[model samples]
Target chain A: MTLGQQILQQLINGISLGSVYALIALGYTMVYGIIRLINFAHGEVFMIGAFVGYFIITLFKLPFILALIFAMIFCALLGIFMERLAYKPLRDAPRIAALMTAVGLSIFFQNLMVYLKWIGASPKAFPRVIEITRFEVIENVYLTSDKILTLGVALVLMLALQYVVHKTKMGKAMRAVSQDKDAAQLMGINVDSTISFTFALGSALAAAGGILYAVSYGKIIYNMGTMPGLKAFVSAVLGGIGSIPGAVAGGMLLGITENAVSAAGMSMLRDAVAFAILILILLIKPTGIFGKNTREKV
Target chain B: MKFRSLIKMGVVFAVGFVLHLLIKVGFINGYYDHILTKICMFIIAAVSLNLINGICGQFSIGHAGFMAVGAYTAAIFTKNPDLFIPAAIAGMPRFFIALAIGGSVAAFVGFLVGLPTLRLRGDYLAITTLGFGEIIRVLLLNWKFVGGASGYFGIKPYANFLSVYILAVITVVVLSNFIASSYGRACIAIREDEVAAETMGINTTKYKIIAFVLAAFFAGIAGGIYAHLMQAIMPRDFSFLVSIDILLMVVLGGLGSTSGSIVAAIFLTIVTESLRRFQSLRVIIYSLVLIFIMIFRPQGLLGNQEFSTPMLKEKIRLLFNRTKSGKGHTSTEGTE
Candidate 1:
């Protein structure tokens, strides 16, 4: 491929990668929006989603779409379970308590998968549910079926999320609670249920991202969530933590920059590049690209 | 004051001599000695981390990064022969110098990192420090002079049970004294309320940096001790997992309690070693315990309370009084 074609190809790949990151970033942004918790275990939820999708396909002989749905639902339930068991009781405690618990839960999920009877400390291959060969768009730039599907599904889920947050009753409740929990409670909104729903929605999106990630990568590991989870978090912060559109923009930006660096023969430094951006963004514009600076009230 | 401190040092030395004699007499075997040294090193790490995360109210997850800086620096100093510091000066004094260099370098790095990031609060500070840790690991992995990802080796084993025990004692004493000082009170004030403390003329940023740098300095010393004891150092030795492990010890011990960190460090090290055979299952159990602790007792077992003899006596008295009062009540009321 010519340089132009190479750039275009990388762009396509970057967008596909970014969309997956966007899906995960949405979960982080949404949860951070409602409750100020970072939810460090959200990454593990994504990992579980991938494992769930893998099992649904391999064990039950389900189609890819059905497996994806099952994975999403399973992860949603897991998210709720996590909030209830590990987070809810600490809702009024020090923030560090919840943060530490999330970190512990993250470790628990990773190790549990590692030592679990069915899943040992090894990477599992994800079976290809839909097979389509790469095709050249203009005699040089090629696109794969997996990339197209990832981008498509990510876009669809994000749109659905937007609708839920803006055009529905539950979404309105979420907005109200996020805006002011006590006031929303006074307005007859169930703050606890809304927060739980926000977790479920975010976890479901993360599950979709996880399934898509496994499908594209063709291999899944127990600790796979650490790096991607971190990068997605960076993306969320980059796009302004509590903003949905900002997450999409940040994810895409991160993907393209990382891919471009790799394309320039710096694959080893790509992770560092992401972290560098995180530090730089934090140092300069901590509110993130799309985040508005809110004055701190005494 | 100087005389009192001298007496304290003499007591510490006497204890160390007795411990060394016990080891020499075969009362403590090599396996147990190793475990004791490890427990000492972990105590240093956990206690120092508690200074920042628990006392200063800053969430610092880059402790292993600081430890790595110290370990690698010490490893390079001892292994490389053509150095500025002469081997003629290379006995106990040399070991101390190497430790100082390791700690100072890590503290310097901590200063640099903290200057930019310490102004941020809570979770943001945590992520930034975590990033710095990963950056340090990556840099160490790629940098060739310190052996990179291949592992640095051939360090002289200057650390022993006696030295580690002494250092551990010094750590606890120095930290306890520091906490009892006014600067430490400033840190506590920052933890209680940064805005209020700032309004009250406390330099929150300065105190935060002081705590972070002091914590890093001790962690670096612990890393030096660790490097000498293991006789080898690797980039993988200092990762996020190490940071999390140290944090777990501090958190489980109860935040803001130095004595609690000491006890928790000893207890958790024993538990971890006992469960070593279980491999991954051990960490799973740890995570469950952590979650349970957060849910049921977020204050931890000690919860800002110290392990003072008077306090323990008082607690026992209180318990006895409660039972005595209950006994005086009707047996049916007690049953109800």
Candidate 2:
């Protein structure tokens, strides 16, 4: 293949992967914005979502769309459950305590999934629900049906998220809570429910991302959410933690950089590259690409 | 004060000598010895992490990276035939030298990392440190000189329980002294309120970095000991999970409490070792314990309180004096 063709192919691959990252990153950025918590178990939610999707398709012989929807609903409920059970009690505790709880929850879910005998700590091959059909986009560049489907679903969900955040009453409440919880409470907005709703929205997106990732990668594991989940966080930080557009942009950039590095024959450095970008961005512009600097109050 | 401190050191050394004799005479068998050595290593790790996270109020989740640096560097020194003196001269002296080199190198790396990233606060600082840790692990994996992903093996077994125990004691003593010093107070002040500390002319960043470097130094020594004990070192061994394990020890013991760290480390090592039979249930139980502890007792098991030797001595002295003075038995109970 020509250089141009390779570049084009990598871009397509990067965008598909980036879309998955964006989906996960959305949950991270939203949670961080609302509560100033990292929500470490968000990755585990993605893992459970993939498992949910896998069971729906393989066990029940359901259609792909149905599996995706069901996974999103289950994950949304799980997210709300986690918030109510673990995080709610520690709402006024020290930030470190909450962070530790998140880590504990992450570990709990990962091990719990393994403890369930039916779902051991082994990778399962994702059944291909969509048939692959390649289309030549350019002289030597090709696009697969899986990539197209991933892109399409991610775009649709992201757009829906955008609409929910901008064009809905809940979104307005979410925005208020994130901006100032005390004022939002004073404004008669149900702060607790809004926070729960944020978790649900973010978790539903993560579920979609998980299924999309499983379908594209053709395998799923109990702990598969760890690396991607971390990378998605890096993307969230890279773009500006609290900004929606920043998460999407950060995800795409991370995906492209990883693919470009792999194409340059340094695939081993792919994971390191994301962290390096994260550190550099943190040092140079801690507020991120689109984040505005806010002064600390005494 | 100097004479008292010297006597304390002598007592510590005497205790260590007795323990060493016990291990030599097979009173403490291999299984117990292994657990004891691990307890020592974790004591060093947990105490050092407490200095950074508990005392200095800086959240560093990448301590294992510094530990890895120390382990790999010390291993390379002792294992390489051509690096220094001949094999005939290579013994305790050589091992001590390698440990020093490892510790110094880790401290330098800590300085490098802490200088740039310590300015950030809370979660951002944590994520940055975590990134540095992953970056270090990746770099080590790619460096073929240290055997890369296959790990560096055949390290000299110079780190016995005695050596680890002595070092762990020394770490605790030094850190306790440091925490009592004025510098330690500054670190505590920063932890309490960074802006307030800065307003009081504490130079918050400098103190934070100092604590970080000191913590990293001890962590390096602990890593060096770990490499020798295991006789093999892998980059994967010092992954993020190991850092979390150390953090768990510090948090469980009560952050900023040296004695608490020591007790917690010993308690956790034994508990984890005993649970080896049920491997899968072990982590689940462990995590559940952590979650419950965080929710119910966020201040930790000791609640930032220390059970110092002096305090114990004072209590014992008071009990003896009360009995000698022929005070009522009820008064003796009130003394406690």
Report the lDDT tens digits of candidate 1 across residue range B278-309.
96898888888878888888777679888764
DockQ, candidate 2, comes to 0.63
A153-218: candidate 1 lDDT, tens digit per residue: 998998899999999999999989888889999999999999999999999999999999999999
CAPRI-wise, candidate 2 is: medium
Q: Cα RMSD (Å) per model?
A: 4.0, 3.1
| lDDT for B297 (candidate 2) | 85
Quote the lDDT for B173 in model 2.
86
- Model 2 ranges off by over 4 Å: B1-11, B84-89, B309-336
Would you list the C-alpha lDDT of every candidate in the order shown? 0.87, 0.88
Pairs clashing within candidate 2 = none
Task: Please report the TM-score between candidate 2 and the true structure.
Answer: 0.94
Model 2, B137-256: lDDT tens digits are 989999999999999989988988888888898899899989999999999999888889989998887898899999999889989988998999899999877787788888888978
Q: How well docked is model 1, in DockQ terms?
A: 0.58
Query: In candidate 1, which residue ranges exceed 4 Å CA deviation?
Result: B1-13, B143-150, B322-336
